[model samples]
Structures are given as C-alpha cells and as structure tokens.
Target: MSRTRRTLIWGALAIVAVVPIAAAAYSPFLAWRSPVYIVAGFAGIIGMVLLLVQPLLAGGYLPGLSAYHSHYIHRWVGAALVTAIIGHVAGLWVTSPPDMVDALLFVSPTPFSAWGVIAMWALFAAAFLALLRRRLHLRFRTWRLGHTTLTSVTVLGSVVHAMLIEGTMENMTKTALCVLVLSASIKTLADLRVWVIRTRRFD
Candidate 1:
C-alpha cells in the first residue's frame, strides 16, 4: 500500500476508535448532573478510552511510530491510565463516600463497582510489578508473563465495569469501545506468543 493510503487508513481507524469516547464526553444528559458527577463520569470515559489506546500502543499500530517510540508512549499512557483511574475513583468518592467505600470493600450492591475495583487494583499491581522488575531481577519472560496476566485482568475487568455502568455513555458507543479494547488486547497478547516461543530457545 502507498504511504498516503496507509496514513489515511490509520487516521480513519484512530477516529473510529475515539469517536465513541468523544460522544460520551459530550453526553447531553450531563446538563442535569452536578459538576462532581460530570467530572467522575468523564474521567471514567477517558480511562475507558485509554484502555483502548493501551493495547494499540503495545501492538505498535499507530502510523509513523517506531516500536521503541510506541513502547515509550505505552509507558506514558500507562501512567496516564493510572492517573485517570485515580481521578475517576476519587471523583466518585467525592460524590459519594459511602458508595466508594462499599465499592472498595467489595460490598457495593452495584455489580460494576466490583469490576472497577478489580481493574483498579490490577492496574496498580501491574505498575508495581514494572517498578520492581529490575530490582527483583526477574527474567524477561517471567516479567512479561506476569505483566500480561495483570493487564489481561485489568482490560477485561475495566471493560465489564464500564459496560455495566449505564451512566453518561451511549450504549452502542460504549459497547463498540469495549469490543475495540478487547480486540486490541487480544491481538497484542497473541503477538506476545512470539516472545514465549523465543523463551524456549533460552530454556
């Protein structure tokens, strides 16, 4: 394919990936909601959108970026993802402390709460693992395995959590984002199989 064509295709894909999120952020229903809830809701939406980007970065799907640059962006995006999650949870807590506490304790009546909590912790665990990787002297394969496992949980749990919430996000758009997130994650994980195969050479 010509470079121009590839660029256009990737650009189109990027727009398709983000349009749902943009629509959710502008949700007309937000007019009736308080600022805190609006912040919280948008934070969650941004985090969900980030989830879709995360795997795409890892898979190096963005046009014109080298794998090294893509991975660098991936790391930064991971940090942003953590920040977004904190903003989301903290905003929700501000809106309702008791509910947030219940969610944290896994006793929230809302099913989405449990999944969000799970994904949150999984994200933290993944970050911690990355931090400790060099200090712990973990093998490359071992680190990859653990990181991938935690990421899988984070992605799946976050998708479920977001889908369950019937808040500001439009249903069809939210579902489409979830599908894209899952597809990107699965594709990246499948690519990781190459790493697994290489590990056998060392073993």
Candidate 2:
C-alpha cells in the first residue's frame, strides 16, 4: 500500500475504533450508573471494539505491521480481548449477582443477555483452542478451521448482543462499528479460501 493510503486506513480505523468509546465516556446516561457498572460497560465496549482489530491483524491487513509483528500483536490482542471480557462479566456479576445468574443460566428476561453469554463462551472457547492447539496435536488446517468457526460464532453473537441492548452506547456509532466489523471479518474469510489449504503431515 502507498504511504498516503496506509495513513488513511489507520486514521479510519482509529475513528471507528475510538469514537464509540469516546461517545460512551461522555454519555449522560452514565451519570446515574454505579462505578462498577460504568467500568463493566466500558470493558464490554472495549472487548467488542477489539473484535474489529482481531481479524485485521489475523489477515495481515493492518498497515505497517510485518507478518511476525502482526501475529505477535494478534496474540496480545487476543489476551486483551479475553481480559476485557472477563472484567466486563466479573464487574457486572459483582454489581448485580442476580442478573448475572439469570444471564448465565439463560433465563434473563432481556434477550441480549443470552446473546452476550453465547458470545462470551464462544470467545473463551476460541481463545482456549488457540492456546492449546499445539499441545492438542491439532494440524494447522484443523486449528484454523476450529478457531475460525468459534470466532465467527463469537462475532455473530456479540454483534447481536450489542445491537439488542438499549444501553449507553450511541446507536449510530454502534451500528457503524458492527457493520465495519462484519464487513472486515467476511472479507478476510472470503479472501482466505481456507478449504484450499492443504494439510501436510508435519503441519
């Protein structure tokens, strides 16, 4: 990519990634919320935003990152994604154990709760697979397939979860972020053509 185009891409990424969080920080709705609730909500927002970054890094689409550095950052981003989610859930649970229980048990009256739970588990599962694929003797292709499937689930569940919530995040920015995340994920997956990847014995 040309230097100018790279700069534009990075700028666009920053806008989409940062705007919603910035908007949330200034939302009037947060004035009445508890500190734990505010922290939990922002953690979830950060986690969802990281979803947009994850696929770009995995597909090496992020500008200026070498393959090694991209993969390295991808791993660290995965760790951050997990931590943000854990903080999101743990904070919420602390703030309201009953709601968290209902959500975890799939009995929450709010439909978004189920989707959030589903996404959380899907993300955790994908992360676990990524961490243990080598120890599990998974081939390269097999690992990719499993990880990609779980990740797709995570993205789908998360987008739905986020969209369904009538919460602090601004609707316009949330929708834009969701569209970008889905478009980027679909583009990367379509480009990979993973079915054509041949699995060798050593791989």
Candidate 3:
C-alpha cells in the first residue's frame, strides 16, 4: 500500500475500534445513576479497556513502541488494572454491601457476580505471583505456566462477567469490547506458546 493510503486505512481502523468504546462510556443508561453506581460502571469500562491493552503490550503488537518500554508500561498498566478492579468492587460494595458480600462468597443470585469475583481473585493471584517470582525461585517455565493460566482465567471470567451484566455500558459496544479483549488475550497466549513448547520438549 502507498504511504498515504496506509495512513488513511489505519486511521479509519482506529476510529472504528474507538467509537464504540466512547459511545459505551457515554451510554444513556449511565446518565442518571447514583454516584456509586456511576463510579463502579465507569471503573468496569476502564477495566475492560485495560484488558485489551494488557495483552497488546505484552505481545508487543503496539506499533512504534520498543520492547523494553512495552514491558515496562505493561507492568505499570497491570498495577493500574488492580486499582480499577478494586474501585469497581469497592464502589459496588458501597452501593450495596450485602450484595457485594454475597458475590464474594460465591452465593450471589446474579450469575455475573460469581464470574466477577473469580476474575478479581485471579487478578490478585496473578499480580502476587509476578511480584514474588524472584523470591519464590520458581523456574521460568513453571512461573510462566502458572501466570498464564491465571491470566487466562481472569480474562475469560472478566469478559463473561461484563457481558452478563445489564448495566450502563451500551450493549453493542460492550460486547464488541469484550470480544476484542478475549481475542487479544487468547492471541497473546497462543503467540507466547510457552506452555506449548515446554510440553513439546518434554514429550
């Protein structure tokens, strides 16, 4: 493709990807919600957006960024994701403590609640393992396997949880974003192929 054509094509693709997210952020259903609900809803949106970025960074797919900077930003973004998850659950808790407790205990009436709780805990576990990698003296293969497993669960659960909730996010956009996030995560894992190669070597 010619340089100008390539630039225009990329720009169009960016717009197509971003407009839905922006529309979801300003979803009409969100307009009159209480502060706590609003905060929780937006936090969830941020979490979904972060989910998409995380794998892209890890897979080094984002253009114009060096591998060193991509990895560095990935770590920082991981921390930010933790904060976003906390804000999401905490805000919901503030709005309804009993419901939050029920969700955490895995007895929530809502189907989505269990998935969110699962993802939240998995996120924590992933971060904890990453932090203690050196101290635990884990082999690279083992650490990678465990980390990848937890992240896979986290992404899957998070996407399902978000999709099940009938909340502020616009349905079409939210679903599109969820699909993108899941695809990005799965693609990243497949590209890494850490576990696949390890198994092949053993076999």
Candidate 1 accuracy as lDDT = 0.85
The collision pairs in model 3 are: none
Which stretches in model 3 have alpha-carbon errors above 4 Å?
1-21, 196-203
Candidate 3, residue 56: how far the Cα is off, in Å? 0.7
Q: Write the per-residue lDDT of candidate 1 for residues 5-124, one digit (tens) a residue.
A: 878968877786578777877888988888988888888888888888888887777778887888888889889889989999898899899999999999999999999999999999
lDDT for each candidate structure: 0.85, 0.91, 0.83
Q: Pairing residues by index, what is the TM-score of model 1?
A: 0.91
lDDT top scorer: 2
Ten contiguous residues minimizing lDDT sum, candidate 2: 194-203
Error of 1 at 47 (Å): 1.0
Please write out the lDDT profile of model 3 over residues 1-203, one tens digit for every residue: 46687677557547645766678677778767788888887787888888888898888877666878888898899999999999999999999899999999999899999999999999999999988988999877888899889988899999999889887778888888888888888899888786653542210
As for candidate 1, its clashing pairs are: none
For each candidate, what TM-score against the reference?
0.91, 0.95, 0.87
Off by over 4 Å in 2: 198-203
